[model samples]
Target: MKTSRQNIEIEKGHAFVTIGMFDGVHRGHMCLVNNVVKLAGDTGGISVAVTFEPHPRMLLSGGDINLRFLTSLHEKEYLLARAGLDHLLVLDFNDQLRMMSACDFVERVLVGMLGMKHLIVGYDHHFGYGGNVNSTTLDDCAGRHGFDVSRVDALVDGDVSVSSTLIRQLLEEGELGRANSLLGYEYILKGRVVEGKKIGRKMGYPTANIEPDWQFKLIPADGVYAVEVTTGENLYKAMLYIGTRPTLETGGNRVIEANLFGFDGDLYGKDLTIFFKHRIRGDMKFSSSELLSKQIAKDKDETLQLLG
Candidate 1:
């Protein structure tokens, strides 16, 4: 797929377009994307997905919010390309676009820039000047611009509808399995291994300390989890720990540490991604180091069983 960043004069064509932040690119978002691609392909039009960078909230909130995200810009681009879309346009959510009304957005972007023949969106999606646009507003815009508009129903995962917001909530609540199901993939945290105190090494469970690549990427709640660690071209089953080492003397800042099973090599300064699979247990404070070590062994066994 072709990608174009801000300020490019797009050559207008018969295009089928959808616009959104598409955070997490969850199953619900994918449903709408698939429709856009299929509609464009069936009618011989270009499939275009217009997404904003840095999130509208980061800019609109005046940078006062501590916002976290599921997927980084690069990850989103890869996912969109995998969805088989023709074009991925990354727009800046600047003052000009933020202040524009629904009519102006439809005229300037969907009509003037893309020459969109059809517009697709998810059920609850609304946008333009404080989310003033919805299915009703889009229909009105389509009448003016002579473009067809379609809205896909919400995709349900188990009992609840799949959504980026819901997935974030699940992760924050330490429900990794449910969140992964909603995402249609594992929740991944990519980072570089950093130097850490040898607490785990002394316990005979050496771990690689991770510093996440994106500062605003969301970290799952404190817990012991079953995960798959990927580095270079190799993957390994691992038990991940996310919390302060309360059993140790130094228990302050939260840390992410993963113990790779049956592997031993230098990992500092290398990039790694942890694909969270299952939540083994919540963070707890043990009475002594021996007790904590014993609990760690149990966690590892449970993680290995889950992998099997």
Candidate 2:
């Protein structure tokens, strides 16, 4: 909760800053942020992270129909704060600012606007209009702007680079183990628990349903998952489903429904966080409600075993 909105000025001092969209604040990003903090600590400087709002890709693409955010601003800020950053600057990614030249961007924004004394950027990171800016030019701009730049190498898993895109692909394909490895933690979705059709309760597997704030937030591949559910107040082991209920003839809108293992109360309208642990099985359509109920019972057993 330690954050200040006022523009910062480091008087005759050094500072560590890294720039990125920091989409999910995944493992790779944590490595960069942690390094920045470690380096800044030794120099008696602040560890600052500079991120943009409304993702740059969404802007450049004229708004993609498939565009999804991994984390909302509130989630991103919370993650960054937990990673021990001294300050976070969430800049508005407007068209005017987006059109600046690489050199101009470095001189003005990195040095003038934020007063960054030292910058840590990823090896393959690009910036400025058209993303034509590279690390070499960043160093050149740093020289002129009276700042220093260090390139953090890409974090890799085997031959694959640990990136937001790769993590998204993993989640989309239902590879929770690999995704969690790359993320350094389970992938989690946060939303407000809402009213559902009450079908689960009738079937004996009562579920708490979450309605997402953003329609375009990417959901993991449709499947059953062993999960840990959390509210701001408590955590519970649960089984979560992410998909359109094929067996129930529920069309299109993907539902995130979870059955808390051992407790129940009126949770409708409460904020819920579901942490993905493992993929149980791919979603399937059943011939009858009875058959579907049988499968769900089996899924619950498997989930409880997984949790153990």
Candidate 3:
């Protein structure tokens, strides 16, 4: 996919566009993206996804709030490209753009700058300053600009709407199955191996400390999880831990580390991408190192049985 900043123009044919933060690029977002692709394909036009940088909330909050997102900008671009979009237009979102009325945005940004022939949006997607215009009102704005508009229905599973917020809640609650089901894929974290206190090593379970790539990336609930780790071309079944280590009593900061079964090598400085598969159990504090070791051994057994 061709990524363009700010304004975009198609040298040949028309531009069919969809607009959103598309945070996490969840299944709900994919439904809209797929529709755009289909429309563009049927009309022999270009499919475009217009997204904002820094997330609208980050700018709107004016440094008052630190927001976590499902995917980084790089990850979002990669997923959109794989979803079959012809172009991804990243708009620089600032105060001026945020204050623009929904009607003006439809005319100036979507219609004027992008020359959007067809506009697509999620079922409840809103427009204008502070989202004054919703999906229903968008059609009238589209009529004024002489462009077509389509709203993909909300993807519902068991009476709940599949959304970024829902997935985030599920992850933070350690509900991997529900989150992964709505995401249409496993949640992942990319990080570099860092040195730890070596307590796990003394207990005969060596683990590599992980430092996540992005501070704004959400960490799931503190617990032991069955995970798959990928580094270079190698993949390993591993058990992951996220907690403040009440047992160790060294510091208050939460630590993320993994022990890869059957792999014995130095991991410091190496990058690893962890795909969370299952939540084995919540963080537990044992009275002694020996007790913790026994529990870890049991956790490993359960992890192996689940992975197999």
Query: Tens-digit lDDT track for model 1 on 1-308?
Result: 98898533545657889988989988888998999999989978888999998799899888854799899988898888999999998988899889999889989877988887888988888788998987777898999889898888999766888888899999999988889888988999999999999789999999999999998899999999999999989999999999988878565899999999988899999999899999999999999999999999999999999998
- TM-score of model 1 relative to the true fold? 0.95
lDDT of 2 by residue, 85-195 (tens): 988877778798799988877777667777778889888888888888976788788777788788888887899889999888888998889988998878878889888
- TM-score of each predicted structure versus truth: 0.95, 0.95, 0.95
Global lDDT scores for all candidate models: 0.89, 0.85, 0.89
Residue ranges of candidate 3 with Cα displaced over 4 Å: 64-66, 135-137
lDDT of 3 at 108: 81
How many Å off is the CA of 144 in candidate 3? 2.3
Whole-model lDDT, model 3: 0.89
Cα lDDT tens digits, model 3, 201-265, are: 98899999999898788889999999999988999999999999898786779999899988899
Ten-residue segment with the worst summed lDDT in candidate 2?
1-10
In candidate 2, stretches whose alpha carbon ends up further than 4 angstroms from where it belongs are 1-6, 250-252
Give each prediction's root-mean-square deviation over alpha carbons.
1.6, 1.7, 1.6
lDDT of 1 at 96: 89
